[model samples]
Target chain A: MSGAFYLATRYMRRHRGKTAVMVAAVTLTLLLPLAVTVLVRAYDRQLGERAAATPMVVGAAGNRYDLVLQALYFRAGRVGTVPASLADDAERDGMAVGIPLHVRYTAQDAPVVGTDLAEYAAFRGLTVAEGDWPRMLGQAVLGHDAAERLGLGPGDTLTTDQQNLYNLARNMPLRLRVVGVLAPTHSPDDRAVFVSLRTCWLIGGHGHGHAPEIHDDEALHRAARLAVEVTEDNVDSFHFHGDMDALPLSAVIVLPDSDKSRTILTARFNQATPGVQALDPPTVMDELMGLVFRVKRFFDANFALVLLATGLLLGLVVTLSLKLRTAERRTLHLLGCGRWLIVQTQAIELGLVLGLSAALACGLAGALTLLAPRWLGV
Target chain B: MIELTDVRFRYDASASGAFELRVDRLALGAGSRTAVVGPSGSGKTTLLHLIAGILTPVQGRVVVNQEELGGLPDAQRRRARLRSMGMVFQDIQLLDYLSVRDNILLPYRLGGGLVLDREAKDRAESLANRVGLGDKLGRAIDKLSQGERQRVAICRALIARPELLLADEPTSALDADTARATLNLVFELAEETGTTLVVLTHDPSVLERFDRVVHVDGGGVS
Candidate 1:
């Protein structure tokens, strides 16, 4: 048997082109399903991991899936927002660490995540790849991919994207200077721009700077126009009116200390609030994966069909190869090879083809797993 | 070392009387050279196969080196043939995928009885050198010419140090000069190894070199 295997390998090497074609064909057949499974499983696992990191998410309760996407992925939508006061209320009892998110704006097409830098960095496991974290209101930190995509680095500046292309009465876009770049985590955060909550309010027209109160409304308008770019000289001039807690937030990520507190929070806001919902992210993502599994089943059936067709084709090839090797088989028989040895020789060739295909399939699967995040951005 | 008695064998095609072999009695002493001469389809190749134990008689005894081969199982028969009887086909059936040395050592690998230990390896190497193929040991069979390939086959046949060597029209395809030379190599190698050589040939000029000559016509050897 071992000699047969050696002969098979030798023959395979001799007919390199035929063996390569067969190996390539079989590799593609195995790779399609293997890569699909590995990448989808990686995506599913990634989604589940990110969702699990945030145990509890609170947002306006219009659509559970939409809120989950908004809280966990920072997906832009017309979904309603909750007040910043809700985050305070959730954290006041010392039951959880409530972090507010204000995701209203973008800078150069990257989402501007207005968050408390320390808490958001801790929750997301973000470490600065370069420079330092933002220390003032007008500074920003770029996510790993965002920095690379925009070709921006520390000490560079980016203007906030215009909010009202159709409305001339809206607040003007502000200028934000880049202070740091975050390490690549292969998450949605890799595509975000992080800014302080105060900067978010500044862009929302909730705050403005004025040197002095002048008599003319035109002068105040001019003063407000002059405050578009926040700087160290104008830092003290920035202020917001009314209660700060009443400011708007896209969502509140609640990291509950215990399962009981998580359940209590979920029950407290589960359909009780008029326009807010507090739910577990993992549960919502499970529902999303349920829908994904249905799509995957279609691929699984198609993959099985392709596999069956490939197997039939390989069988036909083997049969034809056996017919062609009749004279060689006779020669082997005359060379003292038995019926079993003859069969083993043929089997070894096929096994080599299959073994090479399997190895190629595994390599394809591995590459898919590593690159799916960058390709699909999941 | 080689004997056959009351041998009766036929191919499935022989049901209609196309091909059959019946050798009443045959014997060859060790280290002797004998040639069985006949035309094509005259059972010359079939006689060689039966004597080599590659084909079994319908009901008779064939012995090589005093070991009865007709009643052995398929594996044992193959092993016995591989170990004691070496065969050279008319077309020089060397596996082109194997290098020259590997082709020569193929019998040892197949028989499973001959240990490919250092001694057998040394024999294969020396045999290649004897046949002027030592430098071409690792070369593929396709790289060799007709004469070189024929020499490879002879070296392969003798590598097992078998007691009986069978050659089936081994020189029919070569030129007359190369044919004579290849037969001379086979004769000299067999004499040196002290093995009985049974060569089946249609070339009468080469038969005079054999000490004994047997003629076959139809199904019986005379």
Candidate 2:
């Protein structure tokens, strides 16, 4: 046994260059799946965290994926709204209602959302990293990523488009003052632009030539009469004097009061209502993750197969290399080294290379995982 | 001391046409020097291998230092070889990776922290000096000439100061003068250490130097 160990060390030292190369190859092979596994686990963890944070989400019923994306991720294209009467009813039933006044207008391809102050506290779990929340209709607050991307901080201003870029008709832009910047949240809230619900109504009104003139208090009352009305009874009504139909709202977020209220509200809206549906957020997200996991499993299995093949190939190559050194083996045998000892020496050398590679690969994978979110800006 | 009685060995399985060995009886006492002389196909190397515990004769009762070699297990045979025997092969099988000094120290390392005696190291160094390898201790095996590597092998064989020393064609690769000097040094060292020496060689010159000579032919002692 001692002879075998000494021989193993001798063989390793004799072919240091080849052994190093084999170690590197094994390390890289082990590193690939380790890194991929870490990234997949982190991404899965992030998704799970996001899901658990939200108690529920309310959106349109048609295409639940699209609805959740618009409501949670704020990606736009949801064209549904619940009546203000429902929000009033939820609040009356002692529910903490969040009214999402969504407006899908973009400045330089980043979304600008118009929502109430309760939105900052309700679904987002937001905290003020700097400055204060929006105080008035035209005042705005920026999510952490939004602030970074738009190069806007507190005391700066942003001008939002009256419609999305593909709108055939153009209208005036609403000038908004940045009041607060949100901290990093690792959720969709980090990329949102928040403003007062009234600002959304004002932007909606501006497309109808109802924008108030900026001539101080004298012009304000005069333009107030000409502005489009956003009454609870006729929230969808738009004056046709300008591009009123191009008002930029893509969806509205609703919070139901209780289990009974949610059931009543969803039944009332979807069964009898004209052009809207209510969706459950958790169910939609589950369906989305199921699809993602299925695809990921397929790729993971393929990656595992490839790694197994590579390991087998490496083993075969080492075996062939040892066989090719038969003359050396014979010489050692004549020097009183038994055949079993020589074979064991070869095995030990291979084991050492593989063991070291596995350890190094695990470390590299862990480092990549810890740095991934920062690098990808997720 | 080494003893072999009516040894028969076969490299093949067949009853007939098998490589057979028949030695009626032979004994080499402690501190004695003996030579085995034979031509090609004479089983001289096989006899040495058997005595060194490298091979087990199919039919034989061999004993080394009162331990029955034929009845011992493989592991015991290896242990006996490691503790009591030293070998010099014809091709001078020095490990290519290690330096001359490390190769000479291989036996000590193999015995698991049994420190090589200071006296043994001194003796090895002195023997290497006598063989003109005093300056090549740190040189890699492949860097040394055939004769210098053979000299290193001789030093390694004597480093353990074993009770039994087996040399198979130790002077095959050396010039006449160098071979004579190496043989003289080996015999002198064995005498000083009281080691029983067994030399297997095809050359007749080696036969004249040993105290006893045995000629093998057709796998039988003649």
Candidate 3:
């Protein structure tokens, strides 16, 4: 056996170029299918874990996928808004706790999540890893990845991105002070910047603070481009002009007291409200993943065919190689080589090729799976 | 010593015509240097293979080293040939992927009942040095000249210190100077080891150097 192995190693080393090409071909053939399976499993677990945690989502009557995605992942779509008062109505009915969401803007390309920090943080199991929560108006708390990406910590300031620079009616960008950073949750929450709902409304031009000397209404009617910074000294002057209950919210995440309460609340919002719709997040996510898995099945079939073709090609290569080595085999035979030894030598060579290719495929697959979250921004 | 009595062998019939060889009786003494001179398609290589137990005859007994190979099983016959004989093929068939040293050590790796130890390796290197290939042991077969490759083949055949050495056209493709040197090396090694030597050749100049000459024509040896 050792003698057979020695000859096999020598042959492979001497013809290293052919060996390397064969190894690479087999590695890619194994890597493609292995990498796809690993990535799909990771996606399934990640999506399922997050979706199963949220109970229901209420938003404008439009694409329910958009509403659930906006409520859970803060991925804004074309879905319109619902009244912020819906959260209070759900709480008042003693059925469920509603966490209102206002996900209209971005800060440094990270979604800005405007909600009640005390309630939303508890609901999502978010805790401050550094400094305090967003306590004052215009104060911001960043998620772990958000803080790392923005390179901001406590006492630093962040500015919201302006939606339109040319429009005169658009609100001026707000400069927010970073107060805290949340620990990693490994969800979409890690990519968000959390702030108070009033601060978000202020950024939307619903409120402003001005110089104390401007006492006249005509002076108060300044252009929307006039920027505002809420400092501790002038924070008391900032107030909203419209009814607070009529404020726009992108979606509401409802956590019910029981199965009965959930069914009643879902019915109340889905049937009674004219333009508002409530949906189960897990059901919507399952349908979406079903489509994703259907596509994966097609890819799996294609990879199977590729593997078959690779196998056939490898078979042809081995056959041709044996044919080419007929003279060499005869030489070994005349040199007193046994028939069994010849077969053993060639078998060991094939085993070495396949073993190296399998190891490379596994290493590459594991690396790609580990990097999928960072690459896909999960 | 080797003996063949009434050996009759025929090639399998194909598109090419069938040919047969018949040797009524032939005897080669121990440590004798003999030459087999034959025309093309006259079965010189077939005669060498028969003496080495590589081919079986229809109605004859091939006795090599005092064992009748025709009565032995296939495996025992192979073992006897591997242990007691060495052969150099007509084409100098060295594996192209191996270096000169490995090509010389191939018999020990081929399950030939030879143990490959440090002493065996030393003997292989020593034979290569004797054949003027000591410095070129690490070079690939394709990198060597035709004469150098022929010398390597001779070294491989002699590495086992076999009692009998059979060579087919060992110097056929060499220039006169290299051919003489290669033949001289073979004679020196065989004489030093007291090995029986049989060489098949078509060159007339090679006949005078042997103790006895056998001629084959029309599938019969005289």
lDDT per model vs. reference? 0.86, 0.72, 0.88
Which regions of candidate 1 are displaced past 4 Å?
A55-63, A76-98, A104-110, A118-132, A144-175, A181-187, A201-230, A233-249, A254-280, A359-378, B15-18
Model 2 spans > 4 angstroms off: A1-38, A55-62, A74-96, A101-114, A134-181, A190-246, A272-275, A325-347, A361-378, B13-17, B29-35, B97-100, B111-148, B171-194, B202-213
lDDT per residue (tens digit) for residues B36-55 in model 3 = 99898888888888898888
Weakest ten-residue segment in model 2 chain A by summed lDDT: A226-235
> What's the residue-level lDDT of B78 in candidate 2?
70
**Model 1: per-residue Cα lDDT over B72-104, one tens digit each:** 888888888788778888999888878998889
Candidates 2 and 3: which is better by lDDT?
3
lDDT by residue (A232-335, candidate 2, tens digit) is: 33433433443433333444455665777767766665676555566666666777878877887887888788788888989788879878877768665544
For model 1, residues A1-378, the per-residue Cα lDDT tens digits are 476777788888988998899999899999998888887788899889999888888888788888788777878887688888888878867888999999888887888999888999998899999999989878999999999999999999988888877776778788888999999999999999999999888888888775545679678676566227778988789899998988889888998889888887777777566788887889999999999888999999999999999999999988997898787788778878787877888998999899999998998888888888887675
* Candidate no. 2 TM-score: 0.74
Clashing residue pairs for model 3: none
**Candidate 2, residue B24: lDDT:** 83
- Descending-TM-score candidate ranking: 3, 1, 2
Q: Residue A192 in model 3: shift from native, Å?
A: 1.9
Q: Find the number of clashing residue pairs for candidate 3.
A: 0
Which ten contiguous residues of candidate 3 chain A have the minimum total lDDT? Answer: A218-227
